[model samples]
Target: MRQEFTIWLTGLPSSGKSTLARLVEAKIRDRGFPVMVLDGDEVRTWLTLGLGFSRADREENIRRIAHLAMFQNRSGVATITAAISPYQRARDEARRAIGRFVEVHVSCPIEVCEQRDVKGLYKKARRGEIQGFTGVSDPYEAPLAPEVVVRTDRESKEECVARIMERVEELGYLPRGQVRCEVIVPADLVDELGTNGSSLLAVLASREARLGRAGGPVTAEEWEKIEQRLRALGYLR
Candidate 1:
């Protein structure tokens, strides 16, 4: 059976959470995995109507979505949730509810989000037309230690997607035998290391000899540590 997991994208409005979720959904489908996207706005219209913008209501909304994501995960399906999910306590509750959760923090400043607010919601919030709005009248508590953090303000859409994809692959959620190893190095280091740096080559060779006979790719955290060590050793700039 395929391994199942939930990818939760939480951030301020217009932070590119939905865009990244859609891109990830498409990539998962292309890789032959069953995936579902539970967008916040669409869910509010469908599953969470009659719920106001109060803190209690917001918690209930996230709870409902987390339950749904858990259901999909039980059926061997991956779920991508793009929600503002403004409270740390609410997000912690959701993570507890769904054991296999991967929190992806879609980080962008409120100023940028307001500028990208094509719906004029932010303008209204500023003028007191909208009350209890997240990142405006209300608060937006960001994730302290999410599985992945994508800064939409600084990164292109494609780069954001790539970062999420790398996390998904690291988590062993990709289809079996379809894992792709990506080595990220600085521009200056790329020329010196070429296609394979000595450190990376050694790591890959060792993993191939071990896991090739066993199974699975290296964990994302482990790869990150390896990269850090390489950087410290001057192998990566």
Candidate 2:
């Protein structure tokens, strides 16, 4: 891990913030830099588990994510965050929390985002089934001075990814000989490992937690399996 730094990608839902963040991480990883991505949706289940879409909850959500990212950065890891993060104040708070925060606006028009609503969130939002939706029911305040602006509507994924890498380098996140570990693990195994199968599960779970302190959504059956495995291993109460 290198000295701590943070890159925050913010935009409306479906506007490629998550995609760009992943691309950025890929590029950084390829450069041997220690990096972790913290995306909002993945963490919502655990870190901000009880938070709703109300204004206050949303603020707290961003706050929690920012705080965790800052903590990770302090630990000498580069952090990349992706979230709708609609309010300017929330984004600013993140930048302040992480002194080296790089704010990147994954700018794309609402129409473009709606068209790419592969998840159908836009349609659902239009039907009023989802409230507090960005670029629709709620306001998406653009960053007044984002460090970099990546226009998803106008760039290819490769190009956007490259731009993100370039920005990271420009912002000093990349340098020669930075070593970061990238661990890949299976989901089912991660859910049942009982804290002994592998260390990657803990790392992934920790990443999920840092993203927003959101815990994984383990079901009763899954919990039973983990308990059984742990008891069988004599590793739990």
Candidate 3:
């Protein structure tokens, strides 16, 4: 059976945790890995609908999700959870419960999160319409030493996803000696591709498979560019 692990993404609302989780999940699934994403909002609606946003209720919510993640991990399924897990103690407990866990701190300033809030939750919190909202009326204890930290305010979604993938590789979650290659196209060239660039890579990978090549076809220039960026981002040695 494949190695199993859980990636817990903790951050404030609108901090891009869910978005990053989905991106990571897609990449892992594309590589033929068994993966699942436990989004906070969906879980709350389905599993913990009666639970309010009080500190105690939030702790219970996290515990429930952590137990579910642990169950999946024991079955050799990789689990990714995105939640505004406000308290550090609750997250620590989760890490203990889910033994092969990777804590990803999805960080962004409260101001930035408020600006990106499409649901108007932040505005409501600011006006005292909602109580115990993380990063607003309630406290948000940032992770002290998470395995990975992605700054959604400063980095692009692609970059954040790449960083997490690098961590997964380092932790040996991916197949042995198989490092996922992510091509970071320049912004000016992004429009030229006319697709998300994954489609292009998929085509190249398919051709390589037909040719029996060990690795996909990435030009020397492209490889160098990707390596340089990864090294600069401290993802590669």
Candidate 4:
């Protein structure tokens, strides 16, 4: 996550790629390095707005992100990309494009990813609201030889970010011994009824526990936002 590094995040949708990328970016920023996360969803709004969900368009989208990463690397900036990027050919194109391409495969089983439907994408895909969805309608080809692989099922976001930072350091992308941390909370809003003051943390805790029971992916940004709201409401010290 330092200079001249390109971390190509490849995984199925909802496999914790963007979440982990944010964590990694935070850690890198804390170290005073310039970093940017090119998330697929946000990138779609700008770069791939003209592209569809078909195989050809998806490949083109990946190509465009890869090109952007390469350009960033040339300018001595680190690029961390979070994209489904399920096709091996597209990933290969990225590796060829970037100078320091570190492919970090974010591995999560389809069933588990479906269960962690924090974005409601799985439900939409199931209901045929979204077509050519990876792992539902289209295929998700795993990386043949990833530079690093993080299994989302067996790891927390902090741990995954640490692994990626370690890999980037190993590839001489970042300085040695960069530590990473993440704080996640289920972003689903829950009515606290009459809860106030110190009770807000408890309420959020209970809600998060229920979300865990319901199989949701808690995110750090959501937790930070909730903490800010709670502080503004005089809920915590």
lDDT of 2: 0.73
User: Positional deviation of 167 in candidate 3, in angstroms?
Assistant: 0.7
Better of 1 and 4 by TM-score: 1
Q: Give the per-residue lDDT digits (tens) of candidate 3, residues 159-185.
A: 999999899878877764433433333
Model 2: colliding residue pairs = 32-178, 46-214, 46-215, 47-212, 47-213, 47-214
lDDT of 3: 0.75
Clashing pairs in 3: none
Q: Give the TM-scores of the predictions, in the order they appear.
A: 0.73, 0.75, 0.73, 0.72
The digit string of per-residue lDDT tens for model 1 on 1-237 reads: 346789999999998888899998998777766678889997665345456788888987787778777766665567999999999998999899988789999999889998999999999999999999999899999898999999999999999888888887787766444533332333543453455555433332223222311123445554555455545645455
**Candidate 3: segments with Cα more than 4 A from true spot:** 176-237
lDDT of 4 by residue, 120-169 (tens): 88889889999998998899999999999999999988788888888888
lDDT of each: 0.75, 0.73, 0.75, 0.73
Residue 137 local lDDT, model 1: 93
Q: Which portions of model 1 miss their true places by more than 4 Å?
A: 175-237
Report the backbone clash tally of model 1: 0
Best-fitting candidate, scored by TM-score? 2
RMSD to true structure for each model, in Å: 18.9, 7.1, 16.7, 13.9
Worst 10 residues of 1 by lDDT: 206-215
How far does residue 39 in candidate 1 sit from its true spot (Å)? 0.4
Cα shift from native, residue 90, model 1 (Å): 0.8
